[model samples]
Target chain A: MASPLTATPRVTSVTGASQTIPAAAGIGLRAEHYHALLQTRPAIGWLEVHSENYFGEGSLPLTWLERLREHYPLSLHGVGLSLGSVDPLDLEHLRQLKQLIERVQPALVSEHAAWCSVDGRHLHDLLPLPYTEEALNHLVNRIQQAQDFLGRPLLIENLSSYVQYTHSTMPEWEFMPELARRSGCRLLLDINNVYVSAVNHHFDARQYLAAIPAALVDEVHLAGHTRRVIDGVPFLIDTHDQRVSDEVWALYRFAMPRLASVPVLIEWDAALPALEVLLSEAEHAQSIMESDHAVTA
Target chain B: MLSLPELQRQFASAIVDAHAAAQHESLWHDTLLNPGRLTAYRNNFRINIEDALAAIYPVVRRLVGDEFFAAMTRIYAGHAPSRSGNIHHFGAHLPEFLRGFAPTRPLPYLPDVARLELAYHQAFHAGAGAPLSDVQQQRIAAGGYADLMFTMQPALRLLRSDYPALRIWLANRADSDEVPTIDLNAGGDRLLIYRHLDEVEITRLDEPHYRLLALLAAGHRVGTLLNAVSGPSAISRVIQFGLQRQLFSELMIIENTP
Candidate 1:
C-alpha cells in the first residue's frame, strides 16, 4: 500500500473535451425528464450518472443513456464500490463498471470514500469508518487495487456522516487528501458533504479544506442538503431533493478557487425535478465558476 | 464490546434477526438517539430497497393504489432487505415474497401481477443483441432446421400466471386512463416480455404460443418446438406471432446438440 503512495497514479487522458463542462459546472443525469434533456440539450458543462443505474443490459434507461451520450459529456459517479470496507472488493461489480467505462468513455469516474457492505451484506447506505491506521492501510490497499483494476485514477468523495467514530484520529478532509496522496488516487471534493459533516460533527469546514493537498484534488461535487434539527442540534442530511443551500454555496465559493478548473457536477439524486430545473442549476454553478475565476485572476 | 468485525457481525444480526442485541452494551447514546440513528440507517436501508422495488414494480404500484403500494412495500422491504449494492439487481425475490405474503393472498391475483412486472423489469435490462436477418437465416438451409437449437434475445423472458395479469398491467400503465377492477376468475395469462427494438413490450400469448416460446426459449429449434406443442393451429399461431415480433433476430442455431 505504501509503495503506491510514492508512485504517480495512472490517469485516463481527457482526450480533449468535445462538449464537456470545463471542470466548471454540470448536473447529474436523471430519468425524470430524459426526453426534455435530449430535445433541448441544455447548456451545461457536463452530466454525471450513478454507474449502477446503467448496469441493466438494455432497458429504457440504457437506451436513452446511449442516445443522450451523443449529446453531452458523461461522468460515472459511483456510490457502491465499498472502497473502504475490510471485505474483499467485488470483482463482478468492477467488471460491469469497467464495461460501462469502455462503452461510455466517461470523462470522469468517482466513488464514495465510505464503505457499504461487509461480509457480503450491504448496509446499502454510505457508512462511516473509524479512521484508524488499520482502517487507512486497509483503504489505501483497496483504492490501489481498484485503480489497478480500472486502469485509471478514481476520485474518492468523502461521505456525509451522521455518526462519528470515537476512535477516528483524522478528519475526512485530512484523511481524504492523505488517501489520495498515499493511494495514488484523486480526491472528489464534495463541498456539500464537507458542510453537512462539519455541522453534524462540529468541525471547521474551512480548516478541513485548508488541510487538503490541493494538487491531488481532481473534481468537485455541489449538491443540496436537508437540515434535520432533531433536538436543536442541527444535522444536515445530504438529501438531493432541494437546491444547493446558500451556506453550501458559500463553502463552494470558498473551495472553488482552490479547485480552479475541475469539473463540478450538481448532484440531485432524489426528488429529481425537470431537466430544465437541473439545467438552470448548472447555469448557476457555471456563472459562479466563471465569476470566481474572474475575481481570482 | 465487539471489535470492528464483531460490531459488523452483530450489526448484520440486528438487521436480519433483531436478536443481535448482544452488542447493545457497546452502544453509546443518550436516548432513542441510538435507536433513532439506527432507525435512520434502517429507513435508509429499507428505502433504498423500496426504491428498487418501486422501479421494477411500477405496474404493481398502479394495481394497488400508490398509498396501498407504499404500505405493502414497507412490509415487503422489512422482510427482504437488499443483499447487494447495485440496487438494480435487488428485489429478485419479490414475486415469491408476494406469493407467500398472507395479506396479499386475499388478492391472489396480485402475486402474478408482481411476477409479470418482475419479468418485464428483467427483460428491459437483460442485454442487447443484433437480430438475425433473412440473409443470416439462409445459411441454416431447410435440413438442419430441426436439429438447430435457437437462441432467444437477451431481453426475452417467459412468464405465466393464473390471472388476467396482462390486461390488469396494460390498464394500469401510465398511458391508459381506464381503471378496471381485475376479475380473478377471468383467469390467467402467459406473458412474453422482450425488448422489441425500442421499449419493453408485454405480449400476452395463448397457451399454445406460450408453450412454443417456452420450448424454443429453453433451447429447442423449430421442429423440436413443434413437437413440444400439442396442436397444429397453435404451432402456426406461435410462428406467426414470432415473425411479427422479429423474434428470430439473433437466433443462434446450434448444431450437434447433446
Candidate 2:
C-alpha cells in the first residue's frame, strides 16, 4: 500500500516488446518496501506493480519503480475504475492508464472483473457481477473496447464473490473462458480466488480450472485469504494480507501444471509486510515454477 | 450512465443504509445465514479510503493515534464521498472535511496538517513537465526577460496554512522520530511543494516570495508580478530568494518571427 508512484509514467518499458515473457513467479513491488528489495535483490522470477502507483511526476516512487523495472519484467495491474458498470468508461482513467502503459512498457496488464464506480461516484471496492449471459456479453464488449482503445490485449482477472447470483446460469470459470475466446482478451487466473469461490459456492476448484481453456490463460495469481464462520458456515474472503494458504497453494500446484509455465504472482495487499517477506513469497513461487519448468524442459 | 449511477447508488445505499435490503439478493445464498456480505464491501470502501488518507496524511494519522484517526475517517468519509474512480483522487477534500469535523476541531492544527498531506499527494501525481535547467535559460535574450513566459512544473503545490505544517510534516515523516507539539496560537505557514529528480520537496516561503512566485506561476508577466508585490525590495528579494531554491530549470525567450 506504500506509494509506488511514477514520476512520468507516460511510458513503462523501452524493451517490453522485444523481451519475451518468461513463465515464472514474482512478487508485487510496493513503494515503502523498495529500499529493502534493492538492497537484497532477492532471487525471484520477476516483480509486478500496480500501474496507478507510479503515476507521480519525478517522485521517489517512479525512480524506484524504474530501477526495479530494469532488473525484472514488470506487470501492470490496475485497481481503479468500475469496469463492470454500464456507464461509459472514464476517459481520464484510460488516458492515464494508456500513458502508464507507454511509460512502463509492462509485459502484462490486468484488471479485475468487478467494477469500482457508477456514474461518477466511486464505490472503491471490486463489486461482483452475476454470471448471466447478459453480464458475459457486457464484459466481452467492454474487454473488446478496452483492448481496442489501448491498442493491445489485456488479462481480465476473476473476482472472488461471497454471493452467488441466482440469475447466473453459469460459474465465473465458465463465463470467463467464453469471455476470453470471444473478446480475444486473456485470463489472469487467481488460484486463491478459485479456492475461495469453490468453498463459498460449493464447487470443485480443479473442475473450474479444467473448464478454462489452457491457451486462454496468460497469468496466474497466488494470494492469501482469511476465513470467518457465521452460523458454523465458513465463508472465505480474498484478503491478500497473509501467506498463501496450503489449500490454495495446493490448488495452485494443481492449476499451475495445467497452464504449464504461465507467469505467477504473489499478491499481499493488506497489512503489507517488509520487502523481504514479499520477496520470499515470490521466491517460493519462483522455485515452484523453476522446478516445473525443469521437469517440462 | 444511468445504469452506473443506479448501481453506484444502490451499492452506496446497501453499504451506508443498513436498514435497506440489498436489491441484488439473487447474488446471495437463499438461506438465513447471509450474515452481512455488505460489511466486506463497507470495510473495503473504508479501508481503501483510509489507505488513501494514510498515503496523503500519514502525519495526521500518526499524530492522532490509529483508533481516533479511524473514527475520524468514518466522519470525514461520510461527508465526503469520493467522486472519482481513481482512488488517488479520493481524499482531495480532506482538508475541508477536517476543518468541519467536530472531534478534530480540538486539534487546531489538524486542518492545516490535512492541507499539507493533500498538497503532498497532489505534488506526487501532478503532471511531469520538462525540467527548467539553467542551460535552457541561455536561449532567452536579456532584453526579452520581461516578456518571456515560463511554465512551472505541474507537481508544484503552493499554500498558506495557519500552522508550521511543513516543519510538522518533516518532523512527523514516516522515518523521523522527533515529536513536536504545536501551539494553537502559533502563526501559520507559507509553503511550496515541488518535485526535483523524483523527490517531492516542501519548501517554506515568505509572504512576498509566495505572492510573486504564485503570480508568475499563474502566468502574469514579470512587470505585473513585480507590481503585485507590496514593496520595491519585494521584487529583487523574491527573485534572489527564489533563485536560491531553484524553481526554474529552463527559460526560453519568445521570438516573433514574421
Top model number, lDDT: 1
lDDT digits (tens) for residues A195-283 of candidate 1:
98889778898888778877887788888998878877786788888888988777766766666677788889898887777777778
- Measured with C-alpha atoms, the lDDT of residue B130 in candidate 1 is 51
- For residue A242, give model 2's deviation from the true position in Å: 1.3
Cα lDDT of model 2 by residue, B1-258, tens digit: 123345446666666545564555542334213426667677777777787778788899988988887777777766877777777777788888777778876677888888888887787776545544444433332333444455576777889988877777778888997777756567888988887665778888878778787886776556545456685466556555545555653343444421
Q: Fraction of native Cα contacts kept in each candidate? A: 0.33, 0.37
lDDT of 2 by residue, A177-265 (tens): 88888899899999899999788878888888878887899899999999989668788988999999988767666655666678888
TM-score value, chain A, candidate 2: 0.90
**Model 1, DockQ value?**
0.32
Best-matching candidate per TM-score: 1
- Model 2, residue B187: distance off in Å is 1.5
Q: How far out, in Å, is residue A64 in model 2?
A: 2.4
- Candidate 1: list runs displaced more than 4 Å: A1-21, A293-297, B11-26, B29-36, B62-80, B138-147, B174-176, B230-237, B252-258
Model 2 achieves a DockQ score of 0.35
**Stretches of candidate 2 above 4 Å error?**
A1-18, A57-59, A292-297, B1-9, B22-35, B63-65, B133-135, B139-144, B170-181, B230-237, B240-244, B249-258
TM-score to true structure, per model: 0.89, 0.88
